[model samples]
Target: MSENNRYTLITGGTEGIGLELSRLFAKDKHNLIIVARNKERLEKVKKEVEKEFNIVARILSIDLSVNNSCEEIYRFVEKNNFVVDNLINNAGIGSFGSFHELDMEKEEKLIEINIRSLTKLTNYFLKKMIDEKTGGILNVASTAAFLAGPKMNIYYASKAYVLSLTEAIHEEVKDYGIRVSCLCPGAVQTAFQNKAGIMKNDKTKGLMMSPKEVARIAYRDFKKGKVIIIPGFKNKLLVLGNKLASRSLGRKIVMHSNKSK
Candidate 1:
């Protein structure tokens, strides 16, 4: 079957939650344009998803941390005349360290990839979604967004920005039939922790949600126009508790998490 003109553009779609989300979208016969830095991984995922779901999948290798990467991606999509019906800003990075101990250059790239790229991509496609008045945006925030993460401090702050932005835009564009959602999932079974210098703890594994499970809930909730999507039931409760907890208690909790885990 010929693929539809409309496509879902997912950043960081080569693996983890982004990859699972791609499968979900493609299962419905949607065309996809997946962006990731590793060309080999992107091509592999493209071929696998295309064959498994019998849908067209395109790969775009771009480092979202680079300046103007979002602009470059936007231009590529426009130049190719792909009708982006959905935008999934799932590309992000995390740093695990004290604010003073981390390298500033890496921290800057983390912010660039996690915050700036997401905002710019949304800005580029938001108007088009508004004009079409039939699609949505899913910004992948995290459970870290609710409170200050002492160890992964900048990463947490970046997610807070994502959740805030998604909520504000969700309200702004709801009347125009454009859905916006912030996905705030807790720890997931991905290479994120390893990449971020987090040591594996058996204690955390029990709490971790699988990428596919998180993706399923995220996709379902976003489709239903839910503004804040916290995947697991325990995660929802944690977010609630974080909001109600005293500031000192929250700080102590996160600080302990940093020192121990």
Candidate 2:
């Protein structure tokens, strides 16, 4: 497929970092395909982006956590002649409190959306990218990926998988000129806290960077072909500190903070 005909497909592209990232791609004049679970959000973003950037914006509304949704998305784009040359797997969920106390069903849904769906989409688009011998992927992970969090265990582990998978694929496909980047931003001002039922912690708020800032950094670094892109200086330091401390110590600190909230 030719470059001009391909699309930069971003999951969860209607809000937060995902929405900001969509804007960046649109501003750069890439034809876009953005996904969201809500049809209203999907249509709004499509029109909003298309108007501002004068780029083609196709919106898909589907719950990615649903079984076979990723395959459905792959098929939809295939039928539209839209090759996903730039895939951004940004849809994810998180939870707070003790793992045992957290709702099992919700946690399971989080895993399906955060890990399973992302993996399926990546694998689906990867085959096409490999065949074309071009294209890139940016998987939105989190700074939590570098540490084991006691409260948000599933969320952290899922992001770790995303980071690990992207790194491995970055190495595996560099020879084919297929770039894969993992974005690991720290706390951001987004609906994620509300959706995750995480209390509005002042510390988290203080550390938060704007979603637009994170998106700008992610897009820039991804283009430079960085395997892991952490957005801010403070976040970079936190991840660095995690590396310096003993794993148990770092985890205990995270657990205590969660319990305090």
Candidate 3:
């Protein structure tokens, strides 16, 4: 296939970091297959990017949290003959509150979106890329992966799994010329906070990074085949700080940070 024909597939590509990454990839002349739950938003993004970048922006409207949705995405690209040269597993959701008090259904869907679908999609595309002997996978994790979270328990745990899985795959696939990188970003100014039940007055407000900035840095580092891409310097420091401290201390810090002052 020609370089011009290669496509990048991004999940949750209608908003937040995923949306920013779409613009960056499109700016570089990469064709895109963006998957999101909202058909209206997806169509709007597709129209805008296709017109601005002069590249194809195919949109797939599907809820990744649903059963077999990942398989449906794989089939969509295959049927349309879209060669995904890069797969961005960027779809994720968070639920804040005590684990016991949280809605079980939401938590289940969170696991389905953040973990199962990501793993499934990665598995599907990684095989194709390996056969072609070229491709990249960028899994969006978070700094929360480094420490235990209190009120935001399941989300942190899910991100930790992403971090670990991506790191392991990065090592395993480097020999095959498949660049696998995990993007561990700090708090970003996006709908994620509100959706996660995080209040406006939260402490992370001071550290919030813009989605565009995060996506720019992420695209740069991922293209470099960096195994772990932490967007902000302060976020890097936070990860390092957690490592230097005891695990229990790190948990306590996260717990305290979870509270609004």
Candidate 4:
């Protein structure tokens, strides 16, 4: 429980929001164990972060979509005797298109990464934190979690699960001196948009926040023990609007936004 021994473990930390969160944590003098799929990027991030932050940065190069990936990570850190004070379940993927026509293989992989791995990893680390009686967890969901996304069905549903699970866990573990938070940012300018084939219309472009800003707000609010952290005013408004509207209307709004020009 000493400062030197505490580490924040982040998944998909080589790029995008995960990378930004890694930087923020490092800047605050938190040691990091960053996991990602690319070896080169991992090495680069490790070197840069350690040099810039004057803190230890460990790297793990493994794809989270594969089976047993979360267990592998747990074993890796346990073998090294790293104490993960905070667990950031930031690794997730998305696919675009109608549900029926989308590739089932990719959809399954998405679920594995976004849902199964996150769940397993949290279960592994959260137990340790509970025993220790101090820790934090930040699960990155999306504003899309508030409504049904037409073209991006599976991805939205997966995030909804994240939001719901994190909320319930926050209540469950608050008495244990552990903090659990759900980050629900709207449109972030990151590689995820391209990978998800999210064609930003004029409206989405206007709503988009940089990864740096989103990560800044997320880390700040997470430290405050905010259960649901929505990064921007527009995103908060969007979620509120969704809550105020009927489920059918919310679905139509998302479907219209997803339509290609």
Candidate 5:
């Protein structure tokens, strides 16, 4: 793809850090393809981005949690003859409470969206990027990826997979000039907490950060080709502490936080 036509495709781009990242890229003059399940919200975001940045903004509405969703998205792009220069896998869902107590259907959907679908989409885009030999991928993970999250077990595990997968792919594709970065952010003040049932806890509230702050740090690190972008100094310290802390102690800390929720 020529520099003039380069496009960045961001999943879950209607709100939160995904939306903020879209704004940043739009300001940089990259044509955008923003995906979200809500057509109304997507269209609103599309108009706002177009008006503010004076760039083309495309909205793709699809529930990424559904099986074969990634394939469908790939088909849509191919049918439209769209070429992506950047792929941002930012769509994910979280479930709180004991694993057995959570709704089985919801848990399955979380896995489908947070893990399976993200992986599939990354693979699909990475292949295209490798063929072009010039593109980037950003996978949004979480600080929860570093340790076992007792109440949010599946979500944490899914993020761990994202972090690990991105690192592995970064190593594999560096020679090809393809950049892959995993953004591991701590608590961000987004609808995510409310959706995940995390907003009820005081502990989580204490750790909360604004979505824009996280996006700024993440975007900087991503452009610098950092493989792991952990936003905020405190979050960085926590990740480092977790790595050095004893497994039993770390598990205890994680479980203790869950007890309040």
Candidate 6:
């Protein structure tokens, strides 16, 4: 596909790694469609991207946590005649306390957004890309995916699913010339900490990385079709350690770190 005809569609693109990825894509002169629940922030980002890269930036404001969100997004894309060349399933949520302690509604919303919606959107776009014979997919998982997190159980499980799903799809679509990458970033510095209610502990802050650095690494690794892209050296070691450590030991470490604050 010609560069002019291709456009990237990024979810949760108003902030964090998603926003940084949008900026990177814009720098490469690719048209962009950024989806987020915040219309105002999305508009602001669109303007900034257009100003900086001289590329078209389309905004779609919709809550991915809603049950029917995937269908709604699909319909909107069909109605607007937007063809996506790259799909970034970056929207997700996390709960900080014990799963049972959190409100049931909040827990369900987290699952809907982080798992169901991501899967639906990937399936939707993957079909289209397969038919077109060219495209890419990047799903944002987390280092939490490598182990069972005690305090953030549901979020960790959801990301584990993302990593598994992305890897499976990567193998399935390799022959279609479509690259699929799962990004497993550790403790990124963004609104995620506040949203996830992660305690303001020294360990968390010390391990935190800038969203721009994570995005840059993810984008580079993704383009090269890396199956799993962990952004930092520390994170890479953590992932490797998870593989070598006993499952019980890994879970204990996660629980300790989470409760340190």
Candidate number with greatest TM-score:
1
Residue 68 Cα positional deviation in candidate 3, in Å, after optimal superposition: 1.1
TM-score for predicted model 2 compared with the true structure: 0.96
Q: TM-score for candidate 5, please give it.
A: 0.96
Encode model 2's per-residue lDDT on 2-95: one tens digit a residue.
2366799999999999999999999988889888898998889888888898888888888988888888898899887878899999999889
What is the Å distance of residue 218 in model 3 from its true position? 0.1
Across residues 171-221, which tens digit of lDDT does each residue of candidate 4 receive? Answer: 999999999999999888888887877775545666579999999999999
Off by over 4 Å in 2: 1-4
Flag clash pairs in model 4.
none
TM-scores for candidates 1 onward, in order: 0.97, 0.96, 0.96, 0.96, 0.96, 0.96
Each model's lDDT: 0.90, 0.90, 0.91, 0.91, 0.88, 0.90
Clash tally, candidates in order: 0, 0, 0, 0, 0, 0
Evaluate model 1: give its TM-score. Answer: 0.97
lDDT of 5 by residue, 1-261 (tens): 223456799999889999999999888888898989999999999888888888888888999888778888898888878889899999888888888788989988998888888888889989999999999999999998888888888989999999999999999999999989999999888998788777585665657778899999888889999999999999999999999998789879988977777
Tell me model 2's lDDT, rounded to 2 decimals. Answer: 0.90
Query: How well does model 1 score by local distance difference test?
Result: 0.90
**Clash pairs (backbone) in predicted model 5:** none
User: Which regions of candidate 6 fall more than 4 Å away from where they truly are?
Assistant: 1-5
lDDT of 3 by residue, 1-261 (tens): 123557999999999999999999999899999999899999999998998988888888899889989888878888878789999999999888888899999999999999999999999999999999999999999998888999999999999999999999999989999999999999899999898777657556766899999999999999999999999989999999888999999988878878652
**How well is each residue in 77-158 modelled by candidate 1, as lDDT tens digits?**
8888888989999988888989999999999999999988998899989988888888899999999999888888898899
Give stretches of model 3 more than 4 Å off.
1-5, 202-204
Please give the RMSD of candidate 3 to the true structure: 1.8
Which residue pairs collide, candidate 6? none
